[model samples]
Target: MSVIAILVLDGLPGHHLTTPGLVFGTAAREHPGVAYEVRLCAGPGPLGIGLPAPLPIAVPHGLEDLADADVVLVPGHDGPRAQPPPGVVDALRGAAARGARIGAVGTGVFTLAATGLLDGRRATTGWRHTEELARLHPRIEVDPAGSVVTDGPFLTSAGIFGGMDVCLRLLAQDHGERTAGETSRELLTPLLRHADRVQEDIDRERAGSAGIEPTLRWLKARLHLPLTPADIAAHAGISVSSLNRRFRARAGVSPPRYLLRLRLDRARELLLDTDEPVERVAALSGFTSAASLRRHFSRQTGTTPRAYRARHRPATSPAG
Candidate 1:
């Protein structure tokens, strides 16, 4: 049995409090062999949750409950960048130091970032505050484009149903793809809607960027090419180090990491939109070989290329 502790804070969003339980509960119902205990912990106080109607709630567990948790999750509080109350950050730091996998959903990423555990680690938050998060915590590698980012043991997600994405990822990690896929199918409609909405948000964010937009357009046009960081730097007319710094500051990732993400996104699109063979898809996605594509895809997505294609392809499309 795995114990998952949620640190509830005052002014936390109501959905953020429920999302994890909903996911874990659904997973448990689907997989009886997997047992999980979810505990809501917080410092002693009346915690207020913000929903359409604000409500006051109380939890039985305290910060000590996190001591035994296998995973410590932070929910998004009401404020965009408010620090967690006294003792919360300390407890989170203690949990992380003890090897507990720490995750933050939505603005909760700000709370985790405030603990300094996410310093030098990749994280994302609500689309509205990605720049604010980056400005507040320059040491942390902020990834605005990803729906969910897992770096080391720290996981962060952009707001809205991005929390669901994180939970799906957690389910995949805890059980396997079979269980995660079943659970995903159960929530397919909402998940797809969430993906579309998040993509629109990301697209808007990118469209508003003046400096990085042209470079992004150029890179997207050439995603099929096996381009190196030096190639990108030369094309941008800047040193590799300068390119890295500019990308990290403006786009929230290094050039190579961003390129890899772009290629992966293209590969996913190809897998869904066309009945292309894995080898051909790999070639068009700038992967050197199908083997390499499969390796990286499985590592990043927790599913095989064939499974991903099968799962995502349109119903009218023939199986590849």
Candidate 2:
């Protein structure tokens, strides 16, 4: 189970607070193996909202929760320029030091920038505030147009819906694209957006220019066979560590995770595009047996292959 702690500052937007909860909560509810304990934490007092005549609300936890969280989310507050309270900065810096994946949504990026962890890292805030973020924190590279920018453990999203995008990407990393897609469908949302297209373009440029594009293509062509990291390294004509480094630099995910997504994608294609039975699909997609395919497929997609095919593929052909 992953522990997600949302750090709420006084005057934080209510919508921002609930968005992550909705996303991660939905993922956990729909996927069997994915679990998350989400909590809201404020420092030393009742929570305060930015709304006119907002009432004080008590949060269930405090700064201590941030220390042990697997992921800590910071949401936009009402005042973009207001310096984060001393305790907030300290807790954020401490969380970053402890290697908790930290995310700042919208103008919340300002609060994160105040902690200096985002210094020298690629980040972005809401488009409207990007200029101020750049002007205020010259050390941080702010992309005014980026809907989401991830630099290692730190993630920043430009707008409110961008928060949803961040959550889906995190879900993909945790489970897989199929799970993320199902979660998105459950929410009546589309998983891919302009930011993802932009990211794909960036990934493509990086991979192609780095000369590993052919290696990736080759791996895709051969995903139905048993392959190892060492095999991939040899195919790329590089050491394992070098291959990992290049993949990390260009793709933002490890080679194995990338390949797994590829295999699952192929399986999905086969399930939807052909009438092959589950056993054949399993064999063709590199799973050792129908049970292996069923387990992984159900885990990643929240549906059996038969069900997925029934839903996505036509039940009958046109009469000739």
Candidate 3:
């Protein structure tokens, strides 16, 4: 059995403490001969002080347990900007030196960053803390796009549900894509959010803003049509320059890029949910042809449409 040590610090979020068990437990249950032992290692502090009120629980393990652990995970805490608890940094460094894979979830990246292991490595944290992480650790390359960033044995995630994504990725690495995908289905969660889902999240945040809500709705409705920046500008009753500015400000991309993301999202949905041929999927998703769809799809998702469908589509679904 692979031993996973969870280094629990003060102010640990509730979800961070449990996600590993949720994922690994399901994996072991589903796959014969696969086993994982998850241990919660308490940091230097009075335990349970940071958890939600009236739900304190005891953690029996301590930092020494990290020495033999195959994987060490540090969950996000409230005090990322502050120094880590006593001996935490040295313990983490020793674990890494001994060939243990170390990971940090959310603001926990800040804690891991304190050990200098992440220097000159690409990492990510919660989007809100990306700038702070960059400011504090100038040597660590902070990538805000990927929910989970892996450099060598050290992994960091954007936190919250991203914790699940990272854990699933670890599971995939440990076992295989089939095990990871089966575990994801059993847990009823996507292995990772597609790029379009990420863009939709940004759009949702901007949905309340009156400046771009109508245009976003209009764009989604006409995703299948051939559209240009001029068409989008006319729909929004603004000049092309104004449309570009608004899109950049609200959606964080140009109008054309935003539209492409919408089309990609639609294409993904069709590929997974329907048996539509590649040509038909392309036409319906506003790509000029199957070749065009394949090019853009590969650029964004790193796989051809047919391959993506074969990998992710349900077994019972008819092949297109």
Candidate 4:
């Protein structure tokens, strides 16, 4: 069995941080039984400091679990926020030194990057944290804007809603695509060969509500067509003011701002997928012009539209 370890710490976004194991653990239980063993290591051993909560995982292992692991996974965390537990950094470094295949979700990349393991390598984290990740590790070539990026043995994802994608990628590699596709179906989440889920969400944000979810889904389905808050409120069967409050509460963003992200998402796909001129991609994605598209894309992604396309484009093409 290939041992996999997940570090659990204080204030971690429990859901995003834990998805990989649960999802991949499901794969382990399937018919034909793959030899993947998952464990949560508790430590500051062979290193520094002590472990944090959910004490003594019943895995019949300790920090020593990593010493024998084939792969190590770090899930997204909220804290010890930006910095990793000193113990985690040391352990990760040790694991890599021993040749463990490592992966992370969301800001977990920060922890991995801190080990100096990700230097000069491509990695990712939550879309919201892309800039911060890049700033902290410029040599890393951070792709927080994308769902999943593999830099040799270091695998990472724009975590949050992205751990599943990263795990599935690993699954595809360890098992085959049919196994991965089946796992994806069992997971009932979108399949992202590289960066699908996050990118799809970006694609979706355009047709979404300037208000809240589910209701926004209806609106996102119509981005190429013109619509407004009033139209949205009417469609969702709520007064404009009520809709605004609901959106803020549920999505923590205004309806229009959310819609803007969606439009930008679509614009990015066009930039990469089509030979469309920037101006044309702009128009197609509902931006006023190429200039408008570049401004927003750069602001959101920390790289210019063309630069982003060039860097992230499939291996087929040359420089953009």
Candidate 5:
């Protein structure tokens, strides 16, 4: 069984404390041979969680427990910018030195950054605090766009329910995409939906209007179809040139670029969630052929479809 050490700090949100167990427990229950032991570790103090109604928690495990963990998770807290408690940073550094995969959820990235582990690495926090994180930690390349950013073994996620995304990602890495997808479905959490929501948030911010939302929805619904600029323009009741101008002004990309991104996202989801062949995945995601999917997937993600699947899925597992 993989041991997950969650470093609980004061001012922690309630969900951050619970999400890891919820996700991992579901995975273990649904899939045989997948097990995780989650331990809540903290520095010497009475830990108080910062929820709407604040609650104090008694964490039995101390910082030393971090050394024995396969994965260390840090969740967002209210006082993210504040320095971590005594011995917290050293404990985190020790865990990383010993080869534990560490992850930060939401503002928890600040705590991880405090240890200098995230220095010179790509990371992200809640969109609201991306600017602050970048300003504070100039050494860390803060990506404001990604819902989850993984640089080597250290992973950081955006704010709020980003913890779920991080845990799901951890599950996918440890077990396989099939286990992660099943667990996500069991929890009624769609794996790709959060990414889609993040993209929608970016679109709304760039477009500054709801006018493009309908078009985005239309494009997503018809991702399996060979959609053209003319089809998109007709759907929006505009000429191709007007559609291009509107997409550029509002969505910050041309219609073709935006559609390609959507198709890529769909292809990635299919690759992870299903056992469909590359050719079928390409057709399902609106790519013209397997070669088209391979070219675009490689350009965007830096890996071929088979390599991606092999890297993400366990070799011991049978292919469907």
Candidate 6:
């Protein structure tokens, strides 16, 4: 049984503020021996991070709480001026120095970065704030695609609910897969997301120009066809070279990759919805063959198409 401290600063999104209570409280129910001593800590002040009150509980402990914890969890907070609070930063620094694992949920990384703990560390935050985080801490590696990033004692998660994934990761590291899986069952965290799915969708949207958008709409319509980059470029009334440049500049990927991602997403949907064979699904997804589809799908999602389809297909109901 280890003590975990979850620091709640002022201005945290109400929903994000509640996630730790849900996850940790539920985890306590599922695993009796693996007790988690949870606390909501605040700095020394009556208003305490500008939280709305009638205060729920008097501040039991201040920054001193960090020193006794095995792990320190920081939830995203707003009104992070050019720097996070000095006392808050110092407590995190001291905790990390004493070998406590530090985890941040969402924009909470801002607080950790302010302490210089995240310098040169790999980290992530909400997708909307990835660039902002990178710009603020130029030395830190901000990975938009990663749900969690770990460098030494520091770990940071992407967004609000991503904290549960980080918690599961920590549990897996300390105990084992079974413990983490059981904890996940109790917490109900999303098991996994295809690594590039979100990025691919964003890439597709920003990759093309206004003229290219109409052509992309057409390409999506004909995803059943094995359309080439040259064909798409021609449809956009641009040379393949210019179209490639535009996509690279805007979305940071090539046209062909964008198209593949679109087809793959549709394939995933169809796999969930229909009982199509791998070869037929691949053809409809614009992949040249089943093996090719499996290769790319596994690369992107870490799961084979057949396995995913089998797991996701809905069980049929009998007519009443």
lDDT of all predictions, in order shown? 0.81, 0.78, 0.83, 0.68, 0.84, 0.72
Per-residue accuracy of model 6 over 129-239 as CA lDDT, tens digit each: 888988988999786654666656777887756777777766755654567777776655343355357757766677533346677689789988878888888888889
Arrange candidates by lDDT, highest first: which order? 5, 3, 1, 2, 6, 4
Task: Work out the TM-score per prediction.
Answer: 0.69, 0.59, 0.64, 0.55, 0.70, 0.58
User: For candidate 3, lDDT tens digit of each residue in 1-320?
Assistant: 99999998887888889999999999999899879999999865576635555356688998888999999999988788898889899999999999888889998999999999999887889878888999999999887554677667888888877778778878866775678989988986453457558868877776655377888889998889999999989988889998888886786567887898799989988987789999999999999999999988775544588887877664735554
Q: What is the alpha-carbon lDDT for the whole of candidate 3?
A: 0.83
Worst 10 residues of 6 by lDDT: 311-320
Tens-place lDDT per residue, model 5, 146-199, is 467776778899867788888998888777677788888888646457878997
Candidate 4 local lDDT, 19-121, one digit each (tens): 7667777787773766676777755433222224433223345666678877788776555246676577778888888887788887677878888888877
lDDT of 5 at 232: 92
lDDT of 4: 0.68
**Model 6 stretches astray by more than 4 angstroms:** 46-58, 189-320
Candidate achieving higher TM-score, 1 or 2: 1
**Which one is best on lDDT?**
5
* Rank order (by TM-score, best first): 5, 1, 3, 2, 6, 4
Q: Flag regions of model 1 displaced more than 4 Å.
A: 190-224, 228-258, 263-320
Lowest summed lDDT window (length 10), candidate 4: 48-57
* Consecutive 10-residue window with the lowest summed lDDT within model 2: 311-320
Put down candidate 1 lDDT per residue, 133-218, tens digits, no spaces: 89999998787775788776787888777777888878777776568778877767676788789978876675465246677789
* Backbone clash total, candidate 1: 0
